[model samples]
Target: MNINDIKMVGIDQNTPIEIRERVSFGKEIKKALLKFKETYNAEVVILSTCHRSEIYVYSENIALKTIKDFFIEYFKVTEDELGQYLYILTGVDAVKHIFRVACGLESMVVGEDQILGQVKNAISISQENFASGKILNKLFRDAITLGKKVRTETGIKDLALSISYIAVKFISDEFKDLNDKKAFVIGTGEMGQIAIKNLISKGTKVYVSNRTHSKAVDLKKIIPEIEVVPYDDKYVQIARSDIVISATDAPHYTIDYEKFIKVYKGKKICMVDIALPRDIDPKIGEIEGVSIYTLDDLKKTADENKKKRIGFINVIEKIIESAVNNFVNWFKTLAIEPQIKNINKFADVISEIEFERVINKLSNIDERDKKNIEIALKRVAKKMSDLMIKHIKNDIINKKYEEVAIDFIDENGGNI
Candidate 1:
């Protein structure tokens, strides 16, 4: 019944990109959950995104060592490597962290809307795999509700500063105008779509490419002006474009330095890599005419956007507090319900035994008198049960239900 039994272990934007990339589970989330459960016998939910990887667990006994071992083996990280990057949170802090994450307060791009869906998706995947229990299910459901509440109630989401949007903004700031810019976007995922939209909005001619050509073609259908370049010819488009935004979930680098350097025609280009495993090679930034920006580089604009929305942060915090308090209160009730049931059962058992003893002792009395005596005794027992339950309910409201229930049960009889 201790709320502190809930625990979370993971890393976020605070860690270096190299560590983040290594720790990130990406598409292997379901497999990871199964491994975690099989290894630790605990209910778990994992949230992995471009900027963060988090695991939430509910268990009777949490073994940090076991959890750490799972991460070490799964991510192929050494014990020391895991220790440096992993952050552990427990009890109410774990709950608060989840709510904050769902609200996008913990994002690199603060108030970004993508994380909310990511959080929901994490819980959904956990549920689909039966890796979530009552505690995690309730926690995630409330967190999602709180996320929606924060967005609808505040202006925090007014100018949503997503990674994709930040990349485009970074590019926009560098150039006087994007009207004449030829931009090539790699990968047609969510981030790619967002980048394309922002680029098109700024009147830039966009060339889109994805590993799956159909996806790029689909994006072209949405924005008729965009040209869907074949995946193989992406470098040719990259060589020609003034701006490049790469946001793909590819395991390896989509744009390699060796190949790109060979194809370079000395045209100055601004490149932004927004993918997790990183879509572009770091060495490409060394090229004379190429200025490459990774997700870390987008922090400057993200920070500026964060500063603009700092005033509304207090409002969101209050909303999260209220939501968390509500969830904790409900969880407390869940903890106390079992004790309440036990108390009621004890009352019934005691009442029946006492009534039987009195009736047996007065066996010589008339049948009518016996009936009257039994009715009176039953009333007294019912009143006593009602009073005890009233006190228990009061203790629950005051958040002293556990301590008070223990004392009451001990005072009555250890058996109860």
Candidate 2:
């Protein structure tokens, strides 16, 4: 009941978008899960995204065929047509595949954040039907925890995290309250536009500061209330604004503190410096109430996390191993449940025969004693039923259910 137990099947982006969209589990996923569960008797987990659609089930090739049959039957597909693109993973490979996906290693854009939430939502509906078993529950829970850790401990963030988002966080942390603040960004670069968009969305008033006042004036037309401060009065403009984001391409440092200090007579302000060969001085970081982020410092935390995602393989293995143990043990019980019911059916037949034989003898005993005698017989039958189930469960785990079933079927098939 460990990692060696359950089987898996995988499919990738190689399939046509038409086929992939047809199989997507978003809008009508519940309907598909219900059909898969009722028709195939599968403990199924389906992961569908832009890059791949994988099916993981706690069944062998026979069970897998039943699932494939359901898909073909549902889609009305011929065997040859279905054969074009599908990847199947069984045993340990299936276990590892899910771990990688939850960890974000298998994404079309690696380390993208949205897939984890999508995985959780799919499992939730499966559980609402009172259908999900031990395997999926363990795999998904472990995946979520591992994803959070990958973000927290690794420098992978520098390589993978969004640049616009990092800039937003830096601005908010530097300026305690920007509610009443007015900001100015000098350039019309993409980064400059992104910075302005983020600040305004957070309720800060913005002014465009540039040498060609026409571009700044044009920007003011789109944002009607944002005042356009003329570039000639740049130092005076810096004195008037609470936040300044300098992203201009000037030959020298655009805002040297020597000339710029003349306007600042110790007022609270913030700066967002995001230009190459540095728009702002590194030593300016030492100025009172002044802070700076060189290009390297901006994404340092994300860069530190790159290794954590790689090492997460071991942690993922451990979680998947634990999940497999629970799945196999539960699957063993699933196999035994039907055998237990059959044994009950056999005992009921035996009890009926004895009852018919004793019907005439029931008149000899007092009515009360006869009733008690019947209850005792029923209890005896129930006890025997319990014992047989426990014994069969043990036999199944030892891989002897086939022989037991063969004998029972041989004896019962013709008569039943």
Candidate 3:
């Protein structure tokens, strides 16, 4: 987009996860960019992640209208239906928001490291249709740098416990020592595998189960010391497991309460449900001696970490504020520099032509006096030139001469 002016619309966290997932697709970015170009004189980039689906547009109305239209079409929701969940920010605020997101400061888990990678990947994919313009490129570069700063300069980085680790931690807290505690991580999804790795790190006996037997077996092969349980026999594994972390991409619950109660009756079970659809049944949490935690529980734990991480975040915010201000100032100057260069180039030509014109008239004068006259005339010209330069460049920066500025540059080689 134009970099200076930005508009955004989104299916944010306030929207239900089901609705967000329904509209979510890998093709959303490409489709949004293509469709946006039709109705708006602007550039569009779609930022779609599990928690949020937002479109940042350089065009004025397109940013809000185009994205809302897409939401209606993509999610099949009316303006009245989804408007409350969406937010739009313009100009520098939008840029600052993106930087915060890229830095992981706005994540579900505060100070997460994965979001930086996700932001970079999304930026790359969007570039297939849109572009990471100088503005966005510099914004992302600063974001990555800020992420590194947060990691090194703050204890917040260490405090980052992903949903995966949190799930395993919930289970581990129940046991006096996980050294002998048995656990089963169902599914080979990123969350499940991460939970397993974290569990194994805690000295728990780990087993894996997945619909794809190869996936479970592959995980076991990679770990070597782990076990691969049959997907159908998950309840059997659950019965033996002191802790269970279930995170599957399945359309339905993997462990319904009826099946779970049949195998795990009265067993001291610590279950961590990592799936959004919920791999474990709601009733399971009510079972006596059964401790079950879902994404909700993870948020609570994340909230605690966030409180501790807050100390560093205020400092990070200061850095972000200073960095963003400095970036914008430098960025604004970059836009104005070309015009300055243009005016100066023109001045240099006038100075050379006028100097040559006056040189012949001063030939009869003493050498020192002739030089003094030349310098005085050029100095007067330069001062006048400087005043006009500032006025013209300011007009460009303020978009007063935006249309004619490019034409003026093209006509006079100002772009060079």
- All candidates in order of TM-score, best leading: 1, 3, 2
Model 2 residue 329 distance off true place after TM-score fit, in angstroms: 8.9
Which regions of candidate 3 deviate over 4 angstroms? 1-4, 38-41, 60-63, 130-132, 161-163, 166-184, 187-307, 343-416
Cα lDDT, all candidates: 0.82, 0.64, 0.72
1-416 per-residue lDDT for model 1 (tens digits): 77777888888988887788788888899999998888778889999986789889998787766666677777888878766678888888999999999998997656667788889999999999999999999999999998888888785765456878878777977786999899999888878887887687678999988899888876675567789899999888899999999988999999998889888999889999999999899998988888989888786667776676776788889888988887777766675565566766777677778878887876578889877877787777678877876677667757675686866665663465
For every model shown, what is its TM-score relative to the native structure? 0.58, 0.44, 0.55
Q: Which portions of model 2 miss their true places by more than 4 Å?
A: 1-5, 12-22, 60-62, 69-85, 108-113, 138-416
Better of 1 and 3 by TM-score: 1
- Residue 164 of model 1, lDDT score: 85
* Model 1 score (lDDT): 0.82
- Compared with the true structure, what per-residue lDDT tens digits does model 3 show for residues 296-348? 98978777885777677888788778767766655665655665677677767
What's model 1's lDDT at 274?
94
**Ranking, lDDT, top scorer first:** 1, 3, 2
The lowest-lDDT stretch of 10 consecutive residues in candidate 3 is 58-67
Candidate 3 clash pair list = none
